[model samples]
Target: MRRIYQLALLIFSIGMLTACGDDDKPTPKPNPPVEEKEPMPDPISEFIWNGLDVYYLWEADVDALQLKSGTEEWKKYLNGYGSEYEELFESLLYIKPDANGSATVDRWSWFIYDWVEQENAFAGISKSFGYEYRLSKYSDSDGVYGYVTYVVPNSPAAEAGVKRGDIFVSVNETDLDVSNYRDLLYGNDSYDLGLADLDVENNIIIPNDNIVTISAIELTENPILLAKTLDINGTKVGYMAYNSFTGTDEFNLALNDSIGRLKNEGATELVLDLRYNGGGSTYTALILASMIDGNHVGEVFNKRKYNDMLQNYYTDKYGESFLEEYFTEKIENWDGEQLASINSLGLSRVFVLTSDWTASASELIINGLRPYMDVVLIGTQTHGKYTFSITVKDFLDNGEVNPKHKYAMQPIVGKSANAEDNTDYGDGFAPDYIREEWDYLGNIKPLGDPEEAFLKAALDVIAGNNPPVEDNMATRSGEQLETIFDSKELKPFGRNMYDDRIDSKFKDLTK
Candidate 1:
């Protein structure tokens, strides 16, 4: 009986083992379906600072060394001085391998300095002077924050201010620790600010520049000047906010037309608001200077880099020539064309409102007009970026296909100046006055020390004129905004009661 029991148990164990084996062979449940891995992004080429892509450049002060490869005589001259950059200059000159001395850029090469400076002492400096500091303004990388960037020309700040690698500390006096400090600076005509208390722990002030506190202070905008006509006493005072000269012919035509209308409307004096104008074209400076100067004035003579200037350049991202095509047939001559043409408006010296943003072109107007008329530059010191530089921005690649590997780099290649001999104001243009004024939050008003001084000075000058005329800006009919709306295109607004009121005031433009 015991043997029978053992045999039965063994048989049962074998049967259980067979059942388990069969279960394991049944399709293995598909292993839960494996997941797929994603592929990585492809590597592309990159650009570097040192490359062969400089299109625009300030006329360089290159020694014969940079010009050695032209001819046997040229090579002899360059070799005499021990040089090696012949290949590149040849490319710019469009010369073949065997070409000699036929470079024609000299005709277009502008005089770097006034008569007093030495010849080619340096490549293009008009004058040589020393300064302790230079006040500068520039937009942040993203262009949101426009810094009142100042640099010491020869002092430690000049030598060791913020290094290229160090980012500037951006702050607002009103909010103290916050960014967008300009909030304390913009205002609506009447502005006032009282000095505020300081904080010990944070080392910040309580009530900062009032203008900065106003919502009007923003650095991200294009910062071009806005126009506003005002009524002063009985005279017609034309208020024009002149910003950058970068605008095309359309903008200039509008500005010139506005000036003409104002003159015809009986405006005795014109107020040009240049608080936000960061200077631009040489042609632009000439046009503006013509209105201010009594005669053809040689304001500044700049040495433009790249004698082969073709109006605007063409690149993948930025294109030129569009401005020329749209606004004008060609660039107007700075010396004769612009000044001669604009002066036809029948006006005298213009009262211009200036600020730190009043730079290169602005300075030219001031200096150039000095030779032609009495130009009262009433403002804080101008932006000292007197040394004009040509910067060429290009994309460099990593010798591959993907565009992501590219980088944009800019190199300063040339310099500029006005008709006057003076060019090297490395620190900045000095304002006739530097008093600080602020709105309620302590944000500076009148656009800083320079602008405030210029405005008051101009008003004073105009006020003291021989005629001693009363302010007549309020009564001007031809140049009035009311008349501007009288145009057929804009007349549609007349359907409303507001248009009727305006038409009554300005309908008779010729009078």
Candidate 2:
């Protein structure tokens, strides 16, 4: 009876423990698996929107754009389009309306699909047939023709025996016109360019059987075209025909070498020929200014003025010292190697040869130096670009460029001024001595030639000769050619400005 009672109690205890265990085991909860949200599409458009909204100089003036502040709404607006962010960007640009309701300009803002390509172009590197040409009529009713002005060394065009004076009457047997020349010569990598020669007797461009087949390839340019110290009049002067301001280590070394040679030659005066300079780097412009006048290292070289918000933001973050750039005698090359100290003429005045095409950093040199010295302009008006830009890419929180798209926006972000804070060159810096070379249709001369129109004018001015009366000296012994194309079509690239924001700590803040 005792054993039976003990076994019964033990079994009861076991049953109670089993029941407790069963009660302690919580009921398995029924839950659905987590779902990962699809990544937001078209991040590049967001980048464009963010970049332009924050950094563009005329951000407040952008009309017709009611941007949403929330991420969902912004993405919704972006998705409303079919990934054509370029058109959206174009639409978002600040356009100035005329009285007639036509938007005359949004000219400065630009977009680049491939930031790599834009970077290469800014560095004075290009992949093409490698020749710079001008489209113009040689004589009245002679029809439009392409004049080969510059052929890069070791380029396909140079290898094909195309010289500077060679003329092209057609491309792939199609007569050259304003409508077709750029498309034919620059549009494609490979094409047959038809040759032409000047018929002095007939005042026409006669076609020839010579066909030059050209294939495009990458070519790095040497921007220093000609640098020499010439003894003209009674003064020793340094003459440099700089084509472009490519701010690369190789370009800087060459520029330093040129300046060193000028110093060694004891050049008391300087005449910088920038007739063909379409401009490139502003830092190089600063270095060149230092090379011309190294005596003022601590003085303000330039003052950058951003849009109101950015100006306040930069001022608060970087202090008042941020807006000003002082001169420096020492500069490092792109390789981080110390470049030789800059040389200077230390003159009270400098002469710059200009044309309508002389722009950007070239103009920056003209404007930035005026507060310190006399800048004598000796050609036609300039292209009148007074803005600076930065390469803004779509970057995520990790500080990496977003892999979703490869679009880059290079919008005009700010206006620059000299120490005197003068930014008024909108109509271009009118020449102290004006010589319009464009009116003289057939008088294209080699750059370094002393007899060249602009150089001669500069020499005549330096010799104390009074400015000559306006006359058609460019008229060759032929009929005046009727120009079918505008002179602006000859420009290969527009003016460019690199970022002037010196404080790297606040660099990403602007973007």
Q: lDDT per model, in order?
A: 0.35, 0.73
Model 1 C-alpha lDDT per residue in residues 1-511, reported as the tens digit of each score: 9999999999999988997895566654656666553232111100111221222243233333233223454434323322223333333332223466563321111211121221111111211111111111222222221222222234222232322111222223222122332342222312222223423344333443322211111121121333444444565555555655543454555555666666666666666665545555545554555544424433232323222332222222134322111112222432325422453333456665555556656665565444344444444456554423222112223333224322221222234444444556545555443322111111222322223333445555555533222222212222211111101111111111000000011111110
Residue-level lDDT tens digits of model 2 in 1-511: 9999999999999988888795587788989888654346465666777777778888878753345534565656666665787877776777856679994445667887887777787777777676776677544444568666567778898899987657778888888765666677667879898987766555556798999999988778778877887778768878888878887767877897898799889887888988778777777888888888877888988788887888998899789888877777766765446776776667667889887778878888999999888888887788788877777777677777668667888777788799899988777788887776544434557666677677777677777886663434445553443335433233334666666333222236743
Candidate 1 stretches with Cα past 4 Å from truth are: 1-175, 178-236, 297-348, 389-410, 438-454, 465-511
Error of 2 at 228 (Å): 1.7
Q: Any idea what lDDT model 2 has?
A: 0.73
Q: What lDDT is obtained when candidate 1 is compared to the true structure?
A: 0.35
TM-score of each: 0.41, 0.82
